[model samples]
Target: MTRLWNAPDDFPDEMLAGFVAASGRWIRQVPGGVVRSTRDPRPTVSVVIGGGSGHYPAFGGLVGPGLAHGAAVGNPFSSPSARQVESVARAAHQGRGVLLSYGNYAGDVLHFSEAEAALRADGIDCRTVRVTDDIFSAPADRADQRRGIAGDFTVFRIAGAAAAAGLGLDAVESLASRANARTRSMGVAFSGCNLPGVDEPLFTVPDGRMAIGLGIHGEPGIAEVDLPTADGLAQLLVERLLADEEVPLPDGPSSARVVALLNGLGSVKYEELYVVYRRVAELLDVAGVVVADPHVGEYCTSFDMAGVSLTLLWLDDELERLWFTPADTPAFRTGSVRTSLPRPAAAASTERPDGPLPRASAESRQLAARIVTALDAGHAAIDAAAEELGRIDAVAGDGDHGVGMRRGTRAASHAAAAVAQRGAGASTTLNAAADAWSDKAGGTSGAIWGVILRAVGRELGDEADPTAEDLVRGLNRAVEGVTSYGKATVGDKTLVDALVPLADTFAAAVGAGADPALAWSKAAAAATRAAAATADLLPRMGRARTHGERSQGTPDPGAVSLAVLARVVEQSLSPVD
Candidate 1:
């Protein structure tokens, strides 16, 4: 249990603050995360790596002389926002190009891709390599879909080494991709982890049983069996890894050489790990594999999870050489590092003069006030249903949907209220809310809501009051944006499943001469029905796709949240009797 915290929501920020204060020798505080306090003597490709904040050494602890140049940390079990990633990359860039690497989760991919686009727009040469090395997440035929686990260390180390060697962005990316291709990892959990203030663990295993093929983000394992002894467990791990012939062994003279890591997820102590690794070593030797630079400790972890994982990096000449490169960081360290001068402090920003608001019609300002009321209602609705939503999502997903939705809606409501109080128009208020929701929430739901609100805001300009036709048009644009950006369709068991029906129904009602309030009410009802019908769907997108059968009896959490918000907004719009 996570007992020490000011507030559950403040845990990530508080943890990061203490980390920077204690580790000032290696890292410095930045807008999104920490960056290396010292600089290399010469320019090199910046290796920026990150993900959600629960994994300690994985992100912040790895920022140092020969490892990651910076890390973009996010909320617990949530990917960093695009704005966050962009800020860290900008701070870490040293005239040379940047390489962004992280686990291959859906939210991480979306935000990182957005940051990559933004960096390119600013003329910064940036590239991305997603780590997909968890063997059990997907079959060999769909290796690209696997989640990244402890194998992230192999990929990050190689990328950082290539960069420190003064390789160009192209070469660095190639080496990181190669590292990911050669690495394989599998994890088992004896128990689940608890979030900061949550009363229970995300999942649990029966006594004397163990879960296999678990994920780091509080997801339960795919299969469970009776627990085995230390030696038997080592054999199970080794045999499973050796059975995967699809990831062929290293070629040439190094065909039998490999780098093995026995990683503790979180609560498993060092002594127990040593016991397991003892037998793991014997099995590898018997199988004719020569281990090089074997590591046995925590590398990547779930917060306080009782689990361990085994990672094997099949090595060739170049990889083996890179693996032995010296590194100095707060967590992992190797051979001695060369002395380097401290980086110069960043220039302080001067406060800019405030500007007057753009003129807007009184009618538009009146509608903006209503928009704020609707946002408040949406926040209330999500807050009330958050626990239930989390329960539904935990069936197959990471179980953070409810928490994310609550955060987004709360931010959106506050932003909308502040902008509306300043006499802002409907468009400006919605746009402010959209940006706040996305920035604070930081996940797939955040990104999708940002798109939905922004698309609608564009159609509700400040010049005039919006009509039923305008509302329908804005909703249509939102639907188009979501489908295009998220690549999800009606039956994919996502928010799009409910969003599509709601938009189509509203558009039809408005076209038939119904008022905006009536159209919205009808649409909200349709969305509710659509959300409930998702219980029968097999999820074909996002993390749920990996455990599709597990989600069969639960409606999609995204769809349910969308419907709940729509109903609340509709109530705010309808005229009281």
Candidate 2:
């Protein structure tokens, strides 16, 4: 259990602060995470790695001279906002280029993709490599869908080593890619992890039982079984990994050379890991495979989860050579590095200015005021339902949905209030709200909502009071924006299910000459219905996809939240009784 926390939501920030203060010798504080306190004598490709914050020594702890150049830490079990990623990348980039690496997860993918585009737009020459090494997460044929576990160390180290060697962007990317492909990992959990200030663990396991093939984010394992002995557990893990044909053992098992890493998730103490690794090493030796730099300890974690994971990085001559390169970081270090380079100076300011407010007509300004009222009502609704949202999300996804939504709506309201105070139009107001919501929330829903609001804002220009036709066009744009970026369809059990019906019904009603208020009310009803009907859907996207059956009998938290916002907005549009 996480016993010492000032506030649940503030834990990530507090953790980062303490980390920087303690590890000042090797790292300096950055906006998102940390960077090396020292720089290389010459320019080199920057290898930026990140993910959710619960996993220590993985993301932030790995940022230093020869590992990650920087890390974009996110909310617990959530991806960093695109703004955070962009800031870290901008600060870390040298004259050469930047390479972003992280575990394969939906929120991480969405936000990282957005940051990559933004960086490229600024001509920063950015690239990404998502580590997918958990063999148990997906079938061999669908290895691309697998989750990244402790294998992250191998890929990050190889990429960092290549970059430190002054390799070009192409070579750095290739090395990371090859390392990822050559790596495979699997883990088992004896218990679930507790989120800060949360009473219950994300998921629970039966006493005296262990879950096999569990994910790092407290996701339930693929299978459950009675607890086994250390030697028995070692045998199970090694056999599964050895037989996983996804790992190309071209020279057969006996002649294969590999780097073995036995990682304790969190609560599993160092002594326990050594016992497990002892059997693991004995088994490998008997199998005649050469183990290179066999690492046994905590490399990644899940907020005090009682678990351990093993990763094997098959090595060729090049990989073996690269693996021996020196690194210096808060958590992991190898060979010595030049210490003459000075730490980077702190950023002057991270606050982005609100550009000049666009001019608006008197009627549009009044509408913007109303929009602010609607946002206030919506925010209130989310705040009220935050606990329920989290409950629904914990059924199949991480239980942070409610907390994330609450933060997003609060930020949105503040942004909208400020913009409306300046007499901005609907477009500017909504655009500002979108930015704030996404920036504060920093998750899959945050990214999707950002796209939705920005699309709507684009159609409702600052110059005029939006017509029914304009509203419909904006709805269409929002739907397209969400579906395109999120890659979720109507029945994917996401917000799109409610949003599509809401947009279609509203458009149809408007085309039939109903007023905007009536059309929106009817559309809100349709959305509510669609959202409720999602109780029977099996999620095909996002975190829930891995545990589709676990979500049955519950509406998607994203869909339900959207419906809630829609209903609140419609009520605000209606005439007061």
Candidate 3:
């Protein structure tokens, strides 16, 4: 439960509700999504925005002097009626015209499209700028068929700026179309959310897993992978969005600039949102995408849901300048958009050897392979454990640890497979795999897994010859990294519980002059034992803590997954027997 207020379940329609009474948070029941504006203005260039009610400032916040002239409020996931759309449009039009902006959804299409007709009939000059983001929803060519997730902000700024510039409705609408062409979005939901007045969610994508391209209203998605970390998740969304075989870079002064927005559906704090924003900005910088104007915090939302979405608007010379041209609205305040374009990442020179970091011997390769396979086998068990953990987390926390773990695992496995097939050096291979995991998988698990692989790789460096001692040292270092960054210990019911035991077992086996294969086997056994022992231990942190006693009987999902990883190493040791 968030420290917030909600309208009573049975409140009458059109009643001032949802907001705390007299808190001036501003609440009123408008039909469907068509909430009339309370602002004092017989405005010009009215901002008529709507979607489902939960998106917040998306449809409402952008309604102000430098933003929307008026807005139509809708029920959550439900579009305002044509009448409501036209009404808001009428309220916003000054003699010039109305600018219609909303996420791309079926209901929105029907309602807003209908509103266009109604406005034309009423002699109101109204135009629409639909935001079709969520690249994962469809192929880029087919994005029009997909529902908009978070790209509405870009459309708002572009078209809104044009309106602010006193451009005719035609030019403003054209700018919106260009923004729609350039913008893209994707989102992940670990758990489902409930609609206001409804006891249950409309749908669910499952617990401990993420539905890529998942609809804002709990609809199905492109794929279901376990959850990843904030940075990892940010990467997943960005990569999938830019996964066009290649994104054509704009020419400098020529190259394009970008405005980034990290939208928390709800429940996440602004502080955490900025953390994500910084990561995305860093990645964009790497891609040569300059940040012209970055907007964070909750511009759009899903009514207390725990997930977040990213929106990017690629800007050119014309669009970039218009971004900051003042417009009035309740949600967005105009700010400086003047900035330089980002340069492409520096290219590698031919001077140094850039071959695969360092290859491992056949024996070491076998060890790595077995560890990878074992991790794969435990996928089923990991899923079950994650689901249970998520349920527990939902009671108190955001209920996404399980999902994050699952996503990270899937990505890690895929990355490992690609690396092994390529005959890359051990450390280099691990780094590559970790990057893949962090990119495909999202959330905390991916982040931790990436850290673990990198730490181990750093120890291994480029090595053609290695002793058991060397391997043992690397394992120990990896464990240290996990423990250090994850801030968890053996009894915390995290993967460390199993990995810690594995590290100890590896050191003992290597000391006893055991074969690398046998050492890993022993490590696997120890990991399994430690993971099992977790069933009786209390979960002291993260989502597991929310269930209290309920979590006591289930093994930690993280621990089990770690055990699986150990087995993969053990299995890799066996010959083609």
Candidate 4:
């Protein structure tokens, strides 16, 4: 239902440009995202937050005095790359240290962790707090695995306030973690959201059914139910949130104190939210819970998703004080912020590394050329199957898999081709491709692919042509790298399902003295079979897990795409016509 946009790929950049232009007084544009235009007089711990682009006010809108010092924005429904996060953190740090915070997500975790390591290497102290507060996303025993949703506001606000008060990085991070523990949220969707340039919504609900325990990124909900009246829905939301043990108060329900946020996902009207909140307030009053600053509007949103979520932040003494701290931003302003003398701007750097390329044998350079050609064939395969992949993902996911794959492969092919043209070795070309793929794609799949390429690249040195054993070893390393980082196994209904089979079969074939190309062809066939077999399995990881049953009949897009790329790579190994 997101009708207003030019090119979908360009939307994020355009939106950021307009936001900066409109909020110039409060924020300024940086390479990755936005930072405060006015700096504090004294050095203070910087609070930086970020995520995908569609969740407005969540990230950029929260940047200003007494709030986030910077935000590292990414593509729609994608986490920012490590380079982007490092750039924003560097710009925001005032020398006291930096605290990075964001919703807990697979892609966000990988990229932010990388950025944290990079900052440490540069001698800047850094820490991270991943907000995991969506109670419905995981069981109580597995609360740490829950995805962060609208409750991100509570954690971010507490961290920002702590930092603004000149608290050290440790204190700020602790408070942020505490806030995340105290917050709980759940959501429902009447319909799915349409991404810019997409012709259809990510997923759909039956005409009279509603999706319960839905994620903000258009992920299919956990369950379906008959649509309830406004008051009935409000009761449902309040009842669930109140049941959480995090809500603090006297033993009696009526004496409980809480900070409440009733958020509209996107297309839901304010009037509709207010109507629901009316019943929600009545239920809270009946239960004896006292609500503070009960916000009712869009705090975090999915583009045109007809859904809403309720966040309850249980307040202890410290949390209450931080919650009431002064804040001024493009959206959501409260209390008053003290003005401080602006710090002087740092000088800009205008230099690039002037080093010679690493030595690469002519045979290795020839192999690099073949790698470029293989990437091109892979890119073409992804392009050909993009729409089908998107459709498959729509069964239970956000339906962005095809678009993301297209972007990543295109970037990888271009980077590899460029390096190969310059007589780079296979290792150098593959490494550059890995970085480009991760940077341009900006999602879970992208990060995994980056790991895959880099692992293979490291195994194949520039000095010599990769032997069959070397290639098989690299593939094994890639499988291990992906499994370790993504926490997914062969039966997890992820790309690992296909990747593991391919790697194992190829290695087995090589061990039996088969030719590399012949072994790859057989491995590709195994991957194809495994990918198809995923249609009968239920998803056990990622957003699709919420609607596991719904995804039973559809092959995982990630698995299928990987299989397709494997087939293309096999074809690339054949002699040219």
Candidate 5:
């Protein structure tokens, strides 16, 4: 590395200690690897953001107008000292109140709390905001335990700008909380990062796999899985972000869409970052997840580590307007983005659905019962997987896919059980039974369930002993319907990736003179393989693509669930000789 002192003649002030020192007074540091200061906070508002040393653009580089008024740098992966935090608070408070912000971490909390106390003792009116934007870090109810990650920059930028605009401490505090609520983040670490001055990385995970919840400093994760290509990773992030939405106040997604940021750690190239951002923006755009203000760059980092984090901030009207408000800064700059939050719509009919109609046979109803039983048998795994997936989707797609699927499957089973009691026909019974699924499921699953059962009803139209030939026809139509209804194809990282291929295989076996049992077996087997194959594809179309390469290897739960359904259907179709 070139020596800064000996660099040729006139180097940029950014690299000079005099410039750094003159920019602000030496405020103290805070918790979670953050530093703080009040000293000469530029333009109007005082801001704070800090982390460890190596991630340059982070703790120190963000200090400028419209950014941090002060930073509280921690000791590498540790928290900043209390004195450091106190200095920041003292510097930031200029009688107009001071705004303190940083990523959520234990050390940061400890130090910042001390700083808050010290500030009040010194008669300075200071308020601190914690960044807890990562949806994957903890359950929403337990978000206080989550690590803030990169989305902290958005919260700081917006809130800091507002404070500069002369909003009092209350307004700043409210804006900060609202932005934090609107924001969610998730990240995948391919390789562990080294702690400065250490001989080795903090920990290690196998190459070509992702550490799903690896802390910025190499904490253990919810799970570790094979690495994905870039598109797959992007989709994973996007899916989690959308899933984290609060059901959009009973209105559609347009009202729910908000400002989004695609942040890269220090090591990720801008080239790769933009590639991820473009695909994610398109996915969000298609899904109606708004992009009022879109930021794509390295706003945070883990010391040149080869990984990235995804963050979404759900904007209310005030947040949207504030996020776009003009304020110059060395790191963040933006214009206005129109954000809307729709009023909650009154719910539709609440009556228990009409009793299952006639037409669904005892056998088919039995099939539904069996599927439900299988799900029930694996309830723990289902719930766990759903929880994990829900966390994942919270980063990228509509957040409720897990809960939605769980609800849909359980409701379908319940409806079948109810219909069985009433002796409803296979077609009518299943149709009415599916009403619960349609009403209960949300997002893509809701639409998929509607098509799936409609095809079943079509084949069973008032028939006695509808043969496997009838089943084949229904399956074929179902595949076509899924393709048509979703407008997503096999490689788009969708359930169709498994469903279409399975249906085709089943139809081919039947056409080649195989018996119903044999054909069904072939299709079920094909579906299992196809579902696994999806891990190899990127989420080119949906929330999965935003996860990019990080999504590879983890089979999509929807596709896997579909395969399971095929297996159940095939077994049900077989009869004793």
Candidate 6:
């Protein structure tokens, strides 16, 4: 259990504050995460790496002289927002292009991809390489679908080294991709972890049993078996890794050299890891695999999870040279690195001041007040259903959907209220809410909701009163944006399942001459039915796709939350008489 925290929601921010305070030599505080406190002698490709906050050394802890230049931290178990990623990358940029790297999780991909587009639009050279190295997450034939786990260390280190060596963006990206391709990792969990303020672990292992193929986000393992001895466990891990067809041994086993990392998940102690690594070392030696660098400690961790993972990075000549480069960070350090004078304090501010509001008609301004009320109702609905939604998500996905939705809706409501109070129109108010939701929530839900609101807002221009046709068109545009951005279809067991039905129904009802309130009521009901129907769907997208069987009896949290919000919005549209 996570026993220490002022508030569950504040844990990530608090943790980041303490980390920056203690590691002043290596990092300085940025709006989203941290950046190197010292400057390089010359401009080089900046390596910006990150993910959720719980995985320490992997992200923030690795920001320094020879690793990531900056890390965009996110809420616990959630990917950082696109704004956060862009801020960190901009802070770290030194004329040279920026290289973005992180684990290949769905939320991270969505947010980072958005950030990449935004940076490019601003004339900044930004590229990305997603590490997909966990062999157990997907079959060898579908290696690109694998999750990235402890192998993040190998990819980040190599990319950072290439940048430090003054490599161009092309070379740096190629090196990072090569590292990801050669790396393979597998983890097992003896127990699951608890998020701050959560009473129960995200998932539980039965007594005397251990879970295999576990994710770092407190996701339950794909399979369970009787716990084995240290030697037996080491043997099992080595055999699986050696047999990986996705990344074949570079040469015959006798001449292959690799970097072996025995990483401990949060609660597993160092001594126990050494005991496991001892057998792991002997097994690798007997298999004719020469260990180039043997690392045994916590590199990437799930917060307080009792588990361990083994990562092997098969090295070529160039990779081995980069692998041995000196590094100095808050957590991991190797050969001594020469330091330059500390960088002067950054003068640029990340804050963007709000501009004057656009002119709006009297009717549009009145509609903006109603929008705020609807948003308030939606927030209340999400907050009330958060715990149950989290429970449902934990069955297959990382159990942070409820927390994310609460954060997003609350931020959206606040932003809407503030904008409406400033005499903004419906379109301006919705745009403010959309930006706030995405910035604060910081995940797949956040990104999708942002797209939905922004698209709808664009259709509801400030110059005129929104009619039933305008509302229907707005909904249709939202659906189009979501589908284009998220690539989710009606049966993907995501929010799209409910959102598509709601938009289609609303459009049909309005086309039949129904009033806005009547159309909304009918649409909300259709969304509710669609959400319930997701219980029978096997998730074809996102984190839940890997554990589809576990979600067989539960509706997707995203779909359910959308339905809940739809119903609440309908109530705001037409009061009970």
lDDT of each: 0.88, 0.87, 0.61, 0.86, 0.61, 0.90
The per-residue C-alpha lDDT of model 1 at residue 5 equals: 76
Model 3, runs deviating above 4 Å: 1-44, 203-207, 245-254, 335-577
How far residue 236's Cα lies from its native spot in candidate 4, in Å, is 0.8
Ranking by TM-score: 6, 2, 1, 4, 3, 5
- The numbered model that scores best in TM-score is 6
**Residue-by-residue lDDT tens digits, candidate 4, 1-577:** 9988987768888999999999987888877788888888777899999998888877899998878999989888888887678888888888888899998888899889888998999899999999888888888778888899999988889998998888888899899988888888999999999888889888889999999988877788888899999998999999988886655355745666788899999989999999999999889888877897699999999989999999888888888888898998899799988885654455112112434567898877888898999999999989889889989988888788888888899999999998788878988889889988988788788889999999988888787866777778888999999999889997879999999999999999888978778889999999999999999998898878867688998899999999999999888855111
Candidate 3 residue lDDT tens string, 1-577: 2223355222213222433132122222333332322433322355567755557666666654444545665444455445456655654456787778887654466557766876777687777877877766556566566567778777776776676566777887888889888787777666567544444443355666776666665453446788777788878866765565323354532265777788787777788878777778778778777788888887777666777788777777888888767654445656542231221223111122335535566754654564356446544445556655444333323344455455556656666666666665556666766664543333345556666777776665545444567667777888887777556787887778888888899889878877767777888899999988988888665434423465576677667667765665565434111
Query: What shift in Å separates residue 298 of candidate 5 from its native position after superposition?
Result: 0.6
Worst 10 residues of 1 by lDDT: 347-356
452, model 6: CA deviation in Å? 0.6
Clashing pairs in 2: 326-335
- Candidate 2 lDDT score relative to the true structure: 0.87
The root-mean-square deviation over C-alpha atoms between each candidate and the true structure, in angstroms, is 2.2, 1.9, 21.8, 2.2, 20.7, 1.6
Which one is best on lDDT? 6
Q: How many clashes (backbone N, Cα, C below 3 Å) per candidate?
A: 0, 1, 50, 1, 82, 0
The C-alpha TM-scores of every prediction are 0.96, 0.97, 0.53, 0.95, 0.52, 0.98
How well is each residue in 69-158 modelled by candidate 6, as lDDT tens digits? 999999998999888988899899988999999999988998999999988998989999999988889999999999999999999999
lDDT by residue (1-577, candidate 2, tens digit) is 8788998768889998998899988877777777777888998999988888899988988988778888889888888888888888887888698999999988889999999998899898999999999988888999999888899999999999999888999999999999999999999999888888778887788998998988888787878899999998999999998888777767778878999999999999989999999999999999888898899888989998999999999998888888898888889988887774885686422457867788987766777787789889988999899888988888777788888888788889999999999889988888989988887788898898899888888887788867778778889999999999989998999999999999999999988988778989999999999999999999999878888687899999999999999999887854111
